[model samples]
Target: MDVVAFKQFINDQIQLFAEKLGDAKHSSNDGVSLGKLTFYLAVRQSIDKKASEQDMGLVGAFNDTLQALGMVEPGKTFMSKLDT
Candidate 1:
């Protein structure tokens, strides 16, 4: 787990997102609603795709720690076991 590399990756993502944000068309405050939603989804999808390709070892380690502490159960999705 190279901390420097991880930081660089996140910084790169932030810069890219910021550039997209600046380029987003906002002719008027009322006209930006759809554009904002589209940009938000694009950023979210981009981050998810990039993250899936990276080997961030800490993410696995953190999940394992949570499982060991019984904070997370195996083979169960959070959405499937709602408190309500």
Candidate 2:
């Protein structure tokens, strides 16, 4: 995909991450834990969504963002996947 589309995807996923995080941020119940889990899963899903595509470069980028956000370790991801 073009840079614009790739950027849009990243932005959309970031928005989703923020929303999920908000659920935890605003909740006072045990659901806050669930929301945190949701945030992690959502972040992983976002990276996986881009990883399972034609953009190897984008997958690297998504993974970088994950690491930058402290959501995942860099080497922990994209290690076992087949090379394109």
Candidate 3:
């Protein structure tokens, strides 16, 4: 999928997650937590109305950060430099 489509997907997921979590970022009120992408809290947190922007920034940043540390490779990570 392209970035546009990818952002739509993430945004949709975020909306669903937000709804399930009651939009609770930090609290003990009661919720299912971050759900599937709990491991990607920061990434999930970075998500916003501007999903396309955030998505592209994150993917590029991840790629560069890993490359700088000599860890770039095809299908190396769940979130690679995916086009979308």
By TM-score, the best candidate is: 3
What tens digits encode model 3's per-residue C-alpha lDDT throughout 1-84?
A: 555665577667666666666655544633455543442334544443334564556655776777777777644653444565
Give lDDT tens digits, candidate 2, residues 1-84.
544555455566656655665675545554655544444444444445633333555556667787888777667653333233
Locate the minimum summed-lDDT window of 10 residues in model 2.
75-84
Question: What is the lDDT of every predicted structure here?
Answer: 0.46, 0.54, 0.55
User: CA shift at 61, candidate 1, in angstroms?
Assistant: 16
**Residue 78 deviation, candidate 3, in Å?**
5.1
Q: Model 1 off-target regions past 4 Å?
A: 25-84
Record all residue pairs in model 2 with backbone atoms less than 3 Å apart, i.e. clashing.
none
Among residues 3 or more apart in sequence or in different chains, the pairs in candidate 1 whose N, CA or C atoms overlap within 3 Å are: none
Q: What number of clashing residue pairs does each candidate have, in the order they appear?
A: 0, 0, 0
lDDT of 1 at 47: 36
Candidates ranked, most accurate by lDDT first: 3, 2, 1
Clashing pairs in 3: none
What's the alpha carbon RMSD for model 2?
11.2
Model 3 whole-model lDDT (C-alpha atoms): 0.55
Per lDDT, the best of the predicted structures is: 3
The true-versus-predicted C-alpha distance at residue 44 of model 3, in Å, is: 6.1
